[model samples]
Target chain A: MITKDELLQIIYKAVADFNSMQDVDEQLAQQANQVLFSRPGFTKEGLLDSMGLVNFLVTLDDWLDQQESAQSLHFDISDALENKEEALLTIDSLANYILLKNKKV
Target chain B: MSIKNSHILILSDTNQSNFSSYLSKYIKDAKVVTTPFNQLMQVLINPTHAVWQQHYALIIFWANPKSLFPDLEKTLIGKHEMLHVKNFFLRLIDKAERVLFTGFENYPNGFYSQFENISSHNRYALNMMLTSISMESPGVVSYLPGYYSPVVKGLHAVSEDLWYLSKTAWHRTVTDRMASFVADMWKQWHGLSVKLIITDLDDTLWGGIVGDDGWEQLRLGGHDAVGESFSDTQQQLLIWKKRGILLAIASKNDEETALQAIDRHPEMKLRKADFSTWRINWEDKALNIQSIITELNIGAQHTLFMDDNPVERYRVAQAFPDMIVPNLPANKLEVPAFLRSLSCIPATGVLTNEDMHRAELYVAEQQRKNSMTAFSGIDEWIQSLNTVVSIEKLSHQNLTRAAQLLNKTNQMNLRTRRLSEDALWNWSQTPGQAFYTAHVHDKFGDAGLTGLIGVSIHDDELFVEDFVLSCRVMGRGIEETLMNFIISLMTEWQLSNVKVACLLTPKNKPCRDFFSRYLLSDSHEWVFDSKARFVVSGIQCNVIDFN
Candidate 1:
């Protein structure tokens, strides 16, 4: 089973990878344990472009799927991002949401 | 730093947004613009498309032939489609400064001939055709096998969900590595590559230290596993040497002892002759590396250091942060493969005849230096050597190497201009501008094509846009010889005054120093009277007719 701290670290790693790809102005990626602070119009304002969202979500989901505890439990990843109208609010919210879906936890 | 005025276009038939993101991350500075998804054919066949209006420094055709040719299973239809693609691609290559195309089909329609799978052969055929076209393309088009390296036989390369949701063919885990490979490919094309590899001797190069174990006890090639692995490391370094990477030693040992081990070892894959230079003394490895770098006249960023000792590796890394100091795998058995996988190793691309004789060229430079003691003055030494220089109008035969020199020559460059072969040729086509290449041969040996000077005429004052000479032939009166040719060119044009467009850069102080003789009072500009003699004695020049 994955712990909350471990999951946050993975997300932070994905953020670092994301920041490496993005310019300074486009770096909405905060440090680990730091709030992501995404709103509805974040993508519209060009803080994070369409591709950045795809890369971030895909990177996060790939790590979650690789966890041994999540092997049998198919993650409800579509709902994780398909709530597209309401994008990521904070780093903690997504961590809490993933933990809820992880039955082993 | 971003390459000045580098505009890259990603032309893909599949959704390459992730590839673009990864590319932007990897290349960092270049302005990357990705076209709409699956619109490659429209951009390729349509000249009026927005892509054609603006020129690109590089164009990547990331493709998915499965989508491009849905009729691949049908023989006649596929044949027609292939013929159409071939014809238009040739036209497309004419428009790009340099083009990087898909070397493999990333997401084949089906696995190739696996377990009763019949239709996948067409995808394999598609791959083979792309490779064939990339090989024979008249322009600078190279198929990209870079991204495919980190991928293990296409395993985990693609995810069905990502493909369905976003249409990105490559998995996110793999894109970062892919981006690095692409960046290396681009950097190598500009002659920015790791030129020298400094390796440690003790446990890094062999199984045991030469001074302690003695030559007879050192583990190199033999029947044993450890001995074979040690020899394997040497073989890998030898391959890099054959690829034009100069090998040098930086170890804490007696120079003669190390050389003796290299000379006397029965199965040593590397020889004393293979190393261009070395600093095998009991000093700080970083200082030793710096000495070798000074002797070789290459930047630290263009060097790679390999050492098994953690402290030595860290020390060198701290000394030269830009140098590629790879941490050899802890397991000795894995060392060879890990060394082979380093991205800083010289790319197989851009290898010319000059590359094959690069070490010999360095040795020739050393010999020229060695004989310096025999002469009273530098001029006398230069006069002693019978030097002949051939200046040719830019032609296809020498265009590739000329561009390489224009990019590689940093110290002797006037403007520090870097351009691809096609870009250089394109600039020459503009009115009042011409570029000439200089090839030098002396009593010592051939220096190949080592100099370039681009000039433009504006109101009778010949403005020298670029004046570059390779370091190998520097200080040998080649600069004066090239300058003399330029002055003669001015006389032929009936122009009396000449101005150099020299830009002072951190590495280009040598250029400013050389042009100081012609510097106008107080200003950085160098204006010369073309009527005055500017010839180097004991040198013969041949300038081809320029159109």
Candidate 2:
């Protein structure tokens, strides 16, 4: 199973990747870490729009697949995007969900 | 090269936000927008629509041929024709000022390569039709090179996952590579391509330093591996030269000894005549490069300097940051491949007769300069060469070469209205525009199509559109002859006013100074009185009737 620190580091890298394409103003406006990973139910409070969320998630998905232990693990946020949207509200919750999914495997 | 804040519109059937994202990353300051998905045909058909109002400098139309043709399998087997697809894209030629039509790759068709080897029939008919689109369109449309590019790098163009996920046909890498390609091509089209390459003679050109190793020991073409590598490097440089890139040497060595090595070296593929000029001394490479480019009349931005020593490279690189100073591979064997990989200058283009023989033209220029010393005075020297200039209105036959002069001339340009051949052709078709070309020849050699004069005639008044002369024949009386032709034109037509349009550029100060005598006021337009008798001397000028 992946450690929490490893998972958090991946999120940080994904955030940097996301910020690479963003303007400085957008980067500042969307303090992804403050709004995200701030609380369990912070989806509506985050600055990421629908496309931004999908883009960031897709980018994060691509990076995760390149990891050593990812082993064809897909970045499917269907459950979070569906009924359990709060699972993606915070970085900790997302990390726990990923850990839970990997442990199930 | 500075990327002009050009607005670019992406017209494609599929989602090309990836294209916009890449262009945003690479083509800084340029605004890139994609039309709504499935709006390619609508955008192409309705060019005057609101989306086209973005004033896009370029419209990249990338659509998969299979998707466009629907019956691609039948088309490949010759069961169905691809004319409708061709005409649909051809109509887009005049739709925008510039449309970069990214050609379709040989994919699903490429999968049938095993069958292609056994049969004589070609499977890549789609690629051919796409090329024809660019050919018919000319200046208004450009074809992105599809084969053997830096972008191709053995990567699969289509991503299955992306195709399934979001209908994005290609991978992100394709977008990135195409962005770079477009930027480079854009710069080249705007006259920012490399015109000259200045190289070091010692370790850069050959394997060993000629000064330290002596003439006989220099590793150039020979049986040894290092020697062969140097020979390969020379071969690469020769290719660039043949493609119209002028080569010069800037080295720290005795002129006599180094030249002797260059001449006496039996295995040398290059000779003294190959270089336009050389700077061989203990002087700084930076200064030598400066002198070489200055003597040749090329902008520093249009030059590339190469040296094996990093210190020398760094010094020159720092001095001229705009100049291309490739950090050559440390491994001697790798230098040739590295240099070969550079696409700074477009590798593929229609090479005119002038382009193919450019090195010899420069050599002839050197001869002309040398002959200048033989005469007692500058006037006597100018009269001695027996210079004859043939002038004719720019026609379809000589349009390409004249367009070259139109775009390339820097110092002697009057207005510097640089234009592509197709644009120039379209402009010349205007009822009032009269564009003329000057072909110079003398005792030295034929300087093919070295001057251009374009003007717009309105009733009794005339406006000079473009008056440009190549540096090869700058100081000669060609400009005066061309000017005299304009005056004679005014006399023949009985015009009241003649205004020469002049725009000041950093390199075009020569033009400003030339027009200073003709100017009545501070206006860059040097207005001339038509009734004055302006006689041209020292040139046997012949004006061909232009119909």
Highest lDDT model number: 1
Which CAPRI level is candidate 2?
incorrect
**Candidate 1 CAPRI category:** acceptable
How far residue A31's Cα lies from its native spot in candidate 1, in Å, is 7.0
TM-score of structure candidate 1: 0.88
The residue-by-residue lDDT of candidate 2 on B106-170, one tens digit each, is 54444322212211132256566767777876656777656425575765565544554566655
DockQ of 2: 0.18
Compose the digit string of candidate 1's lDDT tens values, residues B1-547.
1166577888776677777777886676577888787687777767899888877777887765544555554554366766776665567576666778765543444532221222456656555666777778533777755346554444466666676667776676665566677788776766677888999998888888889889889877889788889899999988888887889999999999999998988998899999998888889888999999999888898999999999999999999999988878989998987877776666556677788788888888788788889999887888888888889878888887887788878899998987767678889878889999999998888999998989999898889989999988888888988888788888888887888867877788888877775443435687788665654688878776544
lDDT of each: 0.75, 0.73
Per-residue lDDT of B415 in model 2: 74
Q: In model 1 chain B, which range of ten residues has the least summed lDDT?
A: B109-118
| Residue-level error in angstroms, candidate 1, position B193 | 0.8
Clashes per candidate (backbone, < 3 Å): 0, 0
